[model samples]
Target: MSDPGFRTGPDGVRWRDLNHNGVMDPFEDPRLPDAVRVDDLLGRLGLDEKIGLLFHTVIETGPGGSVLDGPGAISKTGTRHVVVDKRVNHFNVHQLGPAHEAARWHNTVQRLAQETPHGIPVTISTDPRHGFSENAGASFSAGSFSQWPEPLGIAALRDEQVCREYAEAVRSEYVAVGIRAALHPTLDLATEPRWARQLHTFGQDPQVVTELGLAFLEGLQRGRLGPGSVACTAKHFPGGGPQADGEDAHFPYGREQVYGGGHFADHLAPFRPAVEAGVAAMMPYYGMPVGLQLDGEAVPEVGFGFNKRIVTGLLRDELGYDGVVLTDWELVNDNHVGDQVLPARAWGVEHLDAAGRMELLLEAGCDQFGGEECVEVLAGLVADGRVSEQRLDISVRRLLMVKMQLGLFDDPFVDEALADERVGTPATVEAGLAAQAASVTVLADEGGLLPLSGSGRAVYVEGLSAQDAAALGRVVERPEEADLAVIRLAAPHEPRSDLFLEAWFHQGSLEFPPGLPVRLRRIREHCPVVVDVTLDRPAVLGPVMEAVDAVVGSYGSGGPALVRALRGEARGRLPFDLPRSMEQVRTHHPDQPGLGDPLLPCGHGIPLGARV
Candidate 1:
């Protein structure tokens, strides 16, 4: 149904001299390309208007950044806009909660979008609306969006059809709620530990990631959000999971994207497929690679978002990506992080000002400035003509093109019925739980010794849910209450650098409270000690390796699967690798091998009971 000449600025339109201006007018159109309409709209607009659409502002709640889905009020208000002199049309990016409540949120946003002159109905995008945690940020709850399994759950099954189903369910949720896009199917290939977002990714294999990423894309955006399926913003492009020293970009004290000397390609693998698959947009990562950005034939300390070599050269030029480039939140240094931070991301990099960062990103072919607060500054640049009118037209036209492609101009209302039926379907939710079950990689089980059924008399639990712990056998929350203690860590919620990741994307001497492992040694003194990590990156397993009788690993899971694995009900030592220690992780990750756990050797977990 796609028009062949849709690439042209005008298509499906018969030129006619409406109003007799002796010029062809859109007023007499059979609907043209969004690019043409964009040009038409810009002709009558001021400098401020075009610049506003360039920034994707965040809704932060104190330290957590954006409170995407509402548990309460929206977080993080702004002090600056790209253009300050005049007010411009603004669009708020929202992460939907549940499928049922989408009607209310859609109406609220629609009212605001409709009131504006251009009436560009705000395009809402979520992480994965059909999945349980569409709002990646916890605490998000509402209605109208579906809830299925997370992508990792699907990957665990390794069933392509299931993955497509996840995408379809999510797409249905997107279209139903009037949300025109979804930002995910993380294709990150979670090969390493320490990267906080592995659960959202496909496995560590490139082929799988490529095949499924496209399938998910087709499922979501091929045809049905608004008038079509929701669009996708393929993220952290050029891939994000080879964390330097396995640290996350968001957590403070968790600074750095440690590269194992030559493991760059591991990170690059997933993205190429996404681009080839024709993702609507690409997101730049928050980490700045020292080797990736060749600054005039040399490397720079600043990251890709601000680095031309990485953003413009490698991604846009070398790869030939023509999609919208969105920055991953505030790229400027964080002065807002107060006591919560311990370490600081202070690498002698060129600390560009906020305004300067914006200018550079645009110059580097970035279409939208995500997580921006300095919209007024951008407006100033446009007003002063530092930013060319020609450039604005190009970016705006492309942006509008995406909107039209998403069919926002065709259908605008939220379909409450669709949201409910598609999201949180019985099959999808089961699949997510299955993914958790499948992803739980059992590292050590002592002597073919797991499925602790009745063996763990009064087992002590640390870190996860009581319900999840109960599945493992006898679970006790207090350390002293059980014969053996099993700890399930929550993935690093604290931003890296203990200071700021954008400030410095590399390694630090981070740990789980000094000598905390020694205490685990004492727990091992009682009977058998089982340690399970729920972190994206592998935690230091010094005492754990020596003292614990069993070990298990998981990412982004709340313990449902970990509990299943603990009972030996589930099989597999995370389809990826588990480093021997923090040292091995820092050195061998993204390139070498996972650690040596007896129960979960190399190719271990092979479904204990069910064939599925």
Candidate 2:
């Protein structure tokens, strides 16, 4: 029955009467039907079920060959605690819709879960999910998850609609399968150039990040796919960049967060926008700062996820953000071989066991644990009466409340086939192309050296394969292939030595591959050169730019916008400033300057034809 107080007029969904109280409630969901399964479920559960939802666990299940492994593993387990047995819930295990084996395996788990007593369908998620790649162990998925040009690749477009389109494309793909949550839209302000994860951010501009991030969150959740409306998590709060020595905080030893730069508030700014936009969740960074707060009392905080002052106090108390707070994966131990990973100490109870840790996380204000074994530990604690049933009930309720708010019960189903309709659809592909085009920056084209009228006797290219040079209407083994040596560059990642991409951070620093300048110089010596920096960032180019007739930052393989820039179809502007030299990056805000060098300032898009 519609509530008499609710007014559902043509205000559209965003502005609709969500509270059913005859008026609009912008971000709040319509008053729900209690969805109080947690209270009753908690009452009925012997200490066992009470602790189940406390932790998001990763069991000893292998990649198990796509989502198909779930069923086979579940049947083999032969344990009641294996609730929906073979449908064991784990992220990145499956959901590759195109792979015949992956799809079959995903469906098998779903079928088995239906037969389960409680039918708790496995909650599946992906880093990105549906795309050309299904990379289980890397920075970006290879086989699935639409790989829209990494956020930095698109930040220069400065078009929120374009960002919204990309988000919608991701949403469409995610909703097809059962990925009701996206651990993405990383809004962490990457205030440092040396940081490895910097490319994942939108850019140096907070306004751009906030607006783009909010659009993405709204688009992902707006569709509200059944069982859950793919929740968007804006991540690594209090900023993740500026890691001391560019190390990650995923390990215990790397957990100390330093705030030497006076821009912690800048990092915090993007998150407030996320909260205002009504995103489904947030991920606290693994880092904790050793800095003293305003009071002069030593406030070296714990990891943001487990810090009561940050989670419950700042996030919940001051800003009033109430959503699921998932910790970054494996927040407890370090996963590296020969790096600094040590036991953590700070902020919370001095001596803590597994149960004690879970207790502290909850008390400090986080709602769920991710990539950890808190579930089994919490269950064991309850069985031993160390954690009370009442305490467990509070957490379970909060988790279930989110599920209900996402309309999961009414829409609990995943289409093993709807994936094709979303993955890199025309709109998605176009967005990718557009981002590629917008990313290029023409640092300097003195005397209008660009818009090279196809008058070169022979156009040569460098670093470009002979095949690619031909695509640009020429040939090239080296720069001597033709008169115009267009070096279409690609930033290489640390090759997957062990099949999975580990230590996944590149310096994003710009130093030409040894003697690339010599090659460009030799080409410059022969003909007017067109050097296309096919990288997203502007490298230390004092030598290269001087030698070349023209230099264009194609921004990673000439994104669609970048390609357009070269063809003189679009104005290639630098969205962020590039340092004129390396020393500039070193002296002025070396630790966390979002823009490394100012060779080309933000918004300096050069229009080759407007040569007035």
Candidate 3:
């Protein structure tokens, strides 16, 4: 095998000789302008290589941090096939064990890319991972990363400084692990109280969401896209809330995002700040707009990824955002994992074939397709003279520009040893722990029963382990034998185990199971019950609130943090309103404020010293 080469320029900066021509290409020269570099690189790529840049699919790594040879959970194409044979340069990685392990896997992926002709360093991206939730389809737990509160928890504090601190910590962890793109800072407004994904958003108010969103973007991007930054993708573009009856967009039944409250522009207000903050990417949601009137014209009831009017007209032309626009995952091809098959979220364009869907996405101004690997479908379109190479270049340029802006071409490798030092460092973990403590909103406390002032009382625990409960006071097995009972409960969701990915989504009615009310009543009968419900969604806590002496809303908080919150060492405020009943949730406009006299309104929280 020949030695595939390097060249030194006049300025003494050695270029990779990416084209292997023994001459320095414009794209290989770090000194060249990004536009010239992108153009030069684009010119050297053939049709297959250009199509490869558009697909960003899921990639799984082995226990040793090497690309797996067998099929992964999402993609049928193996790592080698995707990187070498298929020429894919973008991957959304999932399920790596530790920080150092993920870093090693990332370097391995990059090394595989280095073997390609163009030697384009692969961009690794992930959904929100530095959080408490472990939803497989949505987010990962803080495995080796510093864990912070959910996005809603950050909003509850209502402090941009905290958001900045959190983002900086997340940025450091992400960069250390070789994740150059953060697929989050989900700017979707929590106006829709029952939306499953609201845990990922800053809460209801457009103003507050806008402020925190900007701060988060500034922190992640480090005020610009460069070597030290993880490019933030502020998403579910133009806002994904206002779903009819709080149904999410991930399923067929929840495919419509409506604006019945005439607040289309309000939903989009947060993105304005994100764009102003120079977020590197925008991700359109999977839902199609249903009879949404914007700027005196009705938006077509097509999915945002296929809606040219929304993507090109609204985001591009109206808002003046030219950053890379990536569609939410799996809109082009149906995902078949083992025996179960989930249909593509082609939503309004469901009638279209894969080629038609790709054409619509391109026409809608999407630069890349998320969770999709159908490069052959696109290549066929170009071959048939239906789609032009000129169209392909438009997205390819944006994609390459993002890579250059992130300094991926200059240096994509990370120090594997540094990953251990930087990820979940003492300082980062401390900050996260503090945030967790701060975000535990004390929603309802009857007769000031909180701040569990005096310890050594007999305490009965549920949900939390006995050892963890012992820290507060004497732990008891039975509620009847205790002076006080502390019960922990996650917010209720109707379980859907039909589809493979549906279980990951915590959707459906917020009402608790029929047996839960009976159990809680029995517990409270013995002693004053202190209930802490983890508020992933706005849980319908009417029965629990009615029975318990105190109710606390926890968003991604830990056992120690919960104990601290109970002991009055920290403060929290409600990020969004909690409705009184499921009836109100069904009837209320998804975009409006205050859901028919909420049990606890937004910004309602009791500090340790404050009177309840």
Candidate 4:
């Protein structure tokens, strides 16, 4: 069939002849059904091309958003080598510039893809970028887009509409600059209070996570896949919480995800809603499920990425999710960037070589390998008859289907002018600010210290700037000279200096150092203190709870939003239980919900008038 998208060559050959058979293939036809297009494209792809589709690695852009030539922090391979020589089309972009520049770079990259034999349009994906935190491996800070609270903050608001609106706003900014996939809306239940990555998740409740995940997917995808949509990869599937001893899976020590409560089903509950909502893709976590029993059988104690019982047997067969399944980054080969050498997160399959790991993941039903560019290894597997070419077609079809559904085949280039105008619009900015204000959870309000009068009152502040204090009222040098002390403290973590990216995880003991508590006590004694602490994860708040006259739990609010929160202009309830002490955290099950005595429970928030 002659497809509409194909152009006739000068010698009567079809320009969109993907198979190079001098004819317009069904995949080249825009008018055909997606199934036909995907099947046609999949059948025509060589082993090398198919292998390329399986590797979705990171790429870094230059300062002006041009593709980098050499190695960088996030990626070991160069842009041209991966896209052109290596034949990988899908990329997870890191550290982009202004919208227009990003648009230009995207177009430039698209031109590279267009030069290929198949000319498949590149699919650019990104992690959460419209939030405050700038953790390089996790999420980017809101640079060109409107800044909002983290997912935890949105959960704290406890408003489905706000979650939907936030997703929509994020979609607008992402699509503006050619970002086709959102590597987030982390559906992992934050049951383990001390898990470092909990900031990205909604909370402990499966219902709340499900609702928020649905809302987020609906907003980002606009209820369907098309040009305007940012395909949501609802992540850390089968749930990534329940880390034994509250450790993260990103490191060797935190490699085991133990379900001690025998509530594996509880962790899997949130994913059902995501599947029902039709998420575009799923990302399995790195941790191996240690001694997790499902359906009266023990699941293979392997990382979810390479576990057939989980990805294929459960997520694919039982729940019936046919979408693309991408593994978490660097699961095959060890990554050596600069002085740091991050071992491959193969988990139980650590004994396997790179080729063995790739073959195992393929058999385990992972369609794509995130943060890996070793397409040659997969091709070698096929050549050696360890992995089948027929098996490659299955994943390639899924990948092509997504590309077609995203409207990438029709037109992948973005308009730079529109990108510049659309990103960080006034409406989105206002929406972000509003959400930020609403995420401020007031934990304590002793003696009516909150809703502190803003006019003509001398303010002593820490963490918050003196200039910001001046905006509220008067700024005083010392707490003794002020009516009240306005302070800000991040949720404390026992700092880790080992390994390159270990410090960024923020795992380990969630307690304040002894000196911090003593200093806070002294400051509180000097004057009545109104403290706002950013809760990236649940913290042991025993000392802060005791020393401050009032404590406000912040997810990711700005100076203005913090001021609003202090002045009673903002509102939010706690998303997770704030444990009273480290001892309480120790006694609680990592997988179970609502255990131990909470200082302030989830859904605890003070009303504006109640404090005054």
Candidate 5:
């Protein structure tokens, strides 16, 4: 057999000689059962190669979708160093270019993997990218892909079909670029209004979250995992909302997750549907539990990724979920970028070294390490008698079985021309825009102040582009000279600059700053003010709602979508309640839902022609 060898079977079908043995192996034959193939391939893998299958980390693409030749900022090493030398086959791809170039990059990486010893195909995964959010640690902005509103927007409509369509769009775009796994459809219920990661959740209602999340899971996996599907990883198992002080667990300051109101069961309610539906994967969050008791047992005070009681006992044994369990990013190692260092999210087990963390995570029943590439650490554990080779085989078998089921063993490359045609097509773009328009929640319209009539009326705007606002009416420099004032405000958060990733998360204090209400009052004195607030998380909006003639809540909708909603072209409802004051927000328990007096309740909305 040559370096790149192929063998013809009795049926005249060509198959890659994965082991280069000149014989058509069972793993190489597409007609064989997936279980038989996985078993055959698993027996052939060496210990170090099996260790590589347990790690999935970030891989950077070069300029114009070329493979990185040398070390880069994110990846910290060259492509061949990680792919061939390290024997890593799983990758999480971020910062992609145009569709055709991204497809070319995918094919390039697959070809590189084909020449390796066993010819294992690379399994590429990604965070949610088809939305307006652009946090580097979380999600990316929809660059060339079809753009839609946030997951909160999909939940606001409360339509399962719409959620399915949005997920189907995401699946189509991801599959075109050779992405096999989707790390999203976050089932975390947004019970804590101040949590920074709420934009990706469904809502506070467990029933709504369960129904819509299952639809989204089905859409992405296309009824089952196969060649045409992008496997969905329903995430943050046992829930990630209810952070202490609503701060994210990405930083050290927000490491604790408290269930003071005894609502842990409510938070765990949504994940049952995903488990029952046979979701392809699960991701435990980075937050550690504090004084939490589940089913008459006190859960260990560790991050969910390192808690065996949570991952193995609850998710696997109790829920009967046999899917792959992937830990959230960077649970085992610290991340250093430029002049800053983010310590490992070991949480309660901060004293352990990298190798100790790997051993504990495997014992916790997780299958793969997210955002980590320390194959040497895991290999050393095996050598030191801490981790047995049989334990390594368990995870490797699960990982390889997923790759086979996704049809990556048969063909992993994608057509560049087809990717260009399928991604961000006119139909997908229109559907996304329509969903964005439909997700606009009209909270208030006092005395019928919305649906502005003619286009010639003078309009004054703030926080909106002049080009997009021009479609409604003539743009004016000041509110005094215009017939109406349109202001776009983001739900408030106290800014923090202490940590590197903390600044990106909008945490602490949903109250509006002191000057905002006064500024809105001044603008309203000159002309009737209509305010649109982007509710990534629910806000305390009593003052602004009182001053403005109309208040509309937007869940990541763009300028054009807002204009369409204001012009009576779309309709939406509130997904969660808006607090009346900071006092109310403070007094309400973070883990409980619908327990306090709110300015506007969930499911509250005023239609375009209706008066509040």
Candidate 6:
């Protein structure tokens, strides 16, 4: 049954003839149901093609958004090697160029895919890109996309509507550059303050996280998952928070996840909303459970990706989720970039070989492997009859169904001209700036010292550019020469430089350096000082808060947003608690929320103009 709405040969505009049979196959027809189309495509796939569909690996675009014909900085293989040779269609892109160029590059990749035997279009995914952080493994700084505050900032506003609007902006920008998937809206509750990955999470409250996460998911996906929607892969499922001592599971030292307070149920609460919303995919974290028990049965102490009891028994059977389960990056094989080698985060399964790890993950019911391009290994498993062809078919069907639902088979190419116009428009930029300013939380304001009367008062600034400070008042050389001083500090973390990837993560102690508070106190003596701290991770700001006259918390705001907050043009509230001391932080449970003697509670915030 060929649909007249589509063409097969040179005139194929509305729909692509994926199979290249010179006729519109059932899978190519947009008029048919997605499940029927998926079945038709699944029946035609060879063993290698089916196996290729199950691996979602990293791929880098060349400088100026050109397709990499050879090895890239991150990607070991070239574009042709992954697409044509390996037949892998799913990719997670990082460090993209301008929107138009990225769209052109995407079209080029699709053209390559069209030449393949099955002509399956590539599904491009990306980490959170519309924020301030530029960590290679976590998120990219918003280049061409509309920039907003981090997810923590959005959580600080505590507005569902704002969450929805922020996600809508993300979707529009991503779709413009031909990206089909979002690897975020990190539902993990920031229960552990020292955890390095808290910048992207929605904070500690289950209710707020669930509400905001659902709204964000709804906005990204719209009503139903279709051509216009960007499929969201709500991640680090069953909670990635509660890292043993606030250390990330990305490194070997922080591989254990301990539920010390037995607040495991609280950690799992937010994911129920994501599952209920029918999210396109779920990514399990790398942390292996140390002493996790569910329903009176002890869960296997392996990484969630390789734990059948967690992935299949808990996520599939208990929660009734059948969506594509993608493992977090580098779970199976070690990653080597230059002289640095990051061991595979196999956790409890570290003793297993590559093939052994793959088989276990497949048994655990994960549909795809993230950050891996070893197609030959999986093909060998099937060929040896170790992993059955039937098991491979189950995952292939799920993968194909998603592509069909995304309307990739119908039309995969993006309009480069439309992309340039839609991305980072003036209005979107304004909206993002507003959100950033609105999320600034005022923790302290002694004697109503805020809403700085911009009466050309000489201002001494630290951690802020002199140019940006000029807008507030006269930028002075020293604190003694200024009428008032404004200081900006990032939430402190003990720096680690052992591994290349570990250096990128801000892990370790939340306490400020001993000399920092003393230095701040000296500046306060010269003039009334207002301090702004970027709370990427909740820091133990007892001394700094005491030394400064006014203290404000910023998630990921720039100089303009900080100025707006200080000028009483915007308001914000705390999304998570601030501990009085590092000892208080240590006494608290990793999985519990608001347990310690907080200096300022979760809902604490002062309006700039409000009297103290």
3 against 4, candidate with superior TM-score:
3
Candidate 2, which ten residues in sequence have the lowest lDDT sum?
A: 71-80
Off by over 4 Å in 4: 1-24, 609-612
TM-score of 5: 0.97
Q: How many backbone clashes does candidate 4 have?
A: 0
Q: What are the TM-scores, per candidate, against the unseen true structure?
A: 0.74, 0.80, 0.96, 0.96, 0.97, 0.97
Q: Distance from true position, residue 395, model 6, in Å? A: 1.0
Which residue pairs show collisions in model 4?
none
Query: Which lDDT tens digits does candidate 4 get at residues 1-612?
Result: 123235664556433544446666677776778888888777767777888888898998877878889888878788888888888998998888999999988988887786566878899999999888887789999998999999999999889999988988898888888999999989888888889998999988888888888889889988768879999898898999889998888888889998888778878888897887788999999999988888889999999999999999999999999999999999999988778788999999999999999999989999999999988788888889999888988898889888999988867778887887999999989888878877898887778777866568877888887766776778889887887888888888878876767878887777888787688788777778888889998887768778878888888898887887677755788888988878888888888876556887888888664555
Q: Which of candidates 1 and 2 is the stronger one according to lDDT?
A: 1
Residue range 255-293, candidate 3, lDDT tens digits:
998777777778889998887778899999999989887
Clashing pairs in 6: none
Q: Identify the runs in model 6 with alpha carbons over 4 angstroms from their true place.
A: 1-13, 609-612
> Per-residue lDDT for 596 in model 6?
61
**Model 3 clash pairs?**
none
Candidate 3 regions exceeding 4 Å error are 1-14, 609-612
TM-score, prediction 6: 0.97
lDDT of 6: 0.88
Give candidate 3's whole-model lDDT: 0.86
Q: RMSD in Å for candidate 4, one decimal?
A: 3.1
Model 5 scores worst on lDDT over the 10 consecutive residues at 1-10
For model 2 the local lDDT of residue 300 reads 43
Cα lDDT of model 1 overall?
0.56
- lDDT (tens digit, per residue) of candidate 6 on 1-612: 122133644554356667767777888877789999888888898888998899998898987767898878889799989999999999999888889889988988888887678798899999999999998889999998989999999999999888888988999888888899989879999989899999999999989889998999989888578998989898897899989889899988898998989999888898887888989999999999989898899999999899999999989999999889999998889999887888999999999999999999999999999999999899889888899989998989888888888888888778988998999999899999998988999888776788776658999998888877887888999999988999999889988986767777998888888999899889988999999999999888878878989899999898988887788755778889998888888888899987566888898887664631
